[model samples]
Target: MQTILGANGQIGEELARYLHNTVTHDIRLVGRRPSAVNKTDELFSADLTDAEATDRAVAGSEIVYLTVGLPMDSAMWEERFPVMMENTIAAVRNHDAKLVFFDNTYMYPQTAAPQVEGKTPFEPRGRKAAVRARIATRLQEEMDAGRVEAVIVRAPEFYGPGKTQGLTNTTVFNRIKKGERPLVPVSADTQRSLIWTPDASRAMGLIGNTPDAYGQTWHLPIDQDRLTYREMIAIASEVTGRKIRFSTIPLAVFTLAGLFNAPAKEASELMPRYGVDNIFDTSKFAAHFPEFETTNYRDGISQLLSP
Candidate 1:
């Protein structure tokens, strides 16, 4: 049986759909409250931070996917992420199930340099990034020690339909849909490498099912034609059949707003990434999965804006 931990999240939901449709029908969805993505899916509700609960969740599973996500609170992440990771690793080991971990690019430095799997060093700047780096390192150490079969699938920010949350989706797409002026984080001219949510999930399903793909980190496939915010807005404008205007929010404004706003304060740590080019390299995944086709910006934007 294939099980998905944190099955209610955007990534987890998409992953479950992909697995059910393409890979297996005997799927299990684990979360505090999870709705079935397919008719045959088994619903297992458990808090991953509890060891025994996690063990029960993973019992009798052949392959487990960890796609859990928490709110953007650094304190919450610092307190719970490690415990959840430990619990998951222990549970997966006890059940002798292969683990497919879904990870993000937060641990990498906030710079314009092309982020490559295994080549980029962890130079995390904020509390959240540091926490991500720690958990990821622990997983790698477990992998290197031959403790459990696992594969790490990492992706940059996400932009897609159906409750997808990100700076781009919230600030750009949602604003445009509401007929409000869009807000660009820092520099609208810097290139952004975002992965379509469905594509990322599809790639993860393929890699998790492939036996030889374990014990390595794979960057999820992304469209090669990275676009700047200005260009992205242009595409959205074209798709919506109306002129869309956007204003770039300077770093100082975000920082100032953070002083009084909890969400804004939490988001301040990630503002640096928007100021420069975010060139996430997926050449490794591309070479490995040559048959995979990524959704380009124009088509993806069109789909999101479509009625």
Candidate 2:
């Protein structure tokens, strides 16, 4: 059986569903809330920061998938992320469960092309990036020292069903669904990439089961065809039969608004992504898992738009 931490979240929910339906019925979901996942799987609510609680949550699981996302606030990330990682690492080691970490590409320095796995520099540009980099480095050190077996799976932005909290959905698609003018962070012409949550979760599942994938980092395959934010709205319009239109809010606007809006202030720090083409190269993953495929935007958008 496998344990899925943060099972109520996007990737965790997808991973739990994939495993319960395809791999095994015995799955354990670890989180502080009741999971919306399959009812058959066990739900163990515990604060992962507590080492004893994490140990109990992970006991008896053959593989532990760490999909926990702390609150978006930098203070919360600074305080909780490292503690969670250390506790999780210790717990997994105690139980001898293979660790499969679902990570983001924030640690690497900004680049024009897709950031290649193992090729990107670890030059952090912000507070959140530093924390993520340190956590990844800690995991690598554990693996190098033979203390634990682990694999880090990095993914781009996510958009799919059950992803209502994501940026695209919260700021754009959800607004489109509600017949409101979408408020986007970047310009309409800016090109960016996204991954269907199921596809990313499936990649993690595949890597977790592949012994050869242990102790290394892998990038989850994404749609190679990059699409502009305007084109994304067009796809949503086509899928939902709604006349979706959007307006862009520049970083300066968010910066000024940040003085009054806490969320906006936090969001302004990430506006650099809207100014560049953020792509993730998954050639290594492709070479490792030849049969794996990425779900394109058209199909993925259709799924998200469906009732």
Candidate 3:
């Protein structure tokens, strides 16, 4: 059976749905609560930071999918991520299960070109980025030592129907729904990579089942064309049949806000992405998973706007 760690998360739920509907029916959800998905067995709850609990949760599973989302604060991430990784790694090693880690693009340094899997260098711009880089290196070290079989599937910032903590939902969608100006983090003209969570989950599923995907890092499928915040706003306006106002939150403003707002404090370090052209190259994933397709912003926006 396939075990989904952090099963209550957005990506975890999406992966569970994909597996239940398209791939396998015998799936076990490991989370802090009961299973909410229709086709999953009973949920296994445990604090992943506890190695014994993690080992218990992962036992008897052939494949373990790690989709954990840590708190946003850099200090919290620094304190929690290593412990979780070590415990999970030990558990997966004990069970000899294949690990599919859902990773983010934060580890990659600022780049003008589309980020390729093996080509991007690890040049962290901030504390959070450094933490990500370290975790990735640790995983690679374990894989190289033949302690575990693992694959890292990375995606850019993700948004979808149910996700509410991201810029799309917290800053854009909610403001537009409430008839307020969307608090855009960057200039409306700057283009960057944004992905749909469902598409990323599907790409992860395909990669997990592919034997050759192990011991390598892969980029998940993202939009072929880069899009600006203005373009996305226009798409949302068209899809929802409502005119939306937008106010770009400048870097200086975010810095000031950071003094009182913890989330904004964490976000200030990410301003480089807003000011630069950030893109991801999924050609490697496409070549490997020929049957998979990415969802464009237009369709993705429509899906998010749907009731």
Pick the TM-score winner: 1
How does model 2 score by TM-score? 0.95
lDDT tens digits, residue span 1-307, model 1:
9999999988889988899889899999999998988899999989999999999999999999999999999999999999999999999999999999999999998999999999999999889999999999999999999999999999999999896878889998888888899999989999999999999899999999999999999999999899999999999889989988889999999999999999999999999999999999999998888999999999999998887
TM-scores of all candidate predictions against the true structure: 0.99, 0.95, 0.95
Query: lDDT per model, in order?
Result: 0.94, 0.84, 0.84
For model 2, the superposed segments whose C-alpha errors exceed 4 Å read: none
- Write candidate 3's Cα lDDT for 69-182 as tens digits: 877889988987888889889999999999998888887877576689999888888899999888888898999999999999998887777753576677876677666788
Runs with alpha carbons beyond 4 Å of true place in candidate 1 = none
Candidate 1 lDDT for residue 121: 97
| TM-score result, candidate 1 | 0.99
Clashes of each: 0, 0, 0
**How many Å off is the CA of 131 in candidate 1?**
0.7
In the predicted model 2, the residue pairs found to clash are: none
Candidate 3 positional error at 106, Å: 1.1
Best by the lDDT measure: 1
Q: lDDT tens digits, residues 90-189, model 2? A: 9999998999998987777665666888888787777788888999999989989999989999987777776535678778877776678989776787
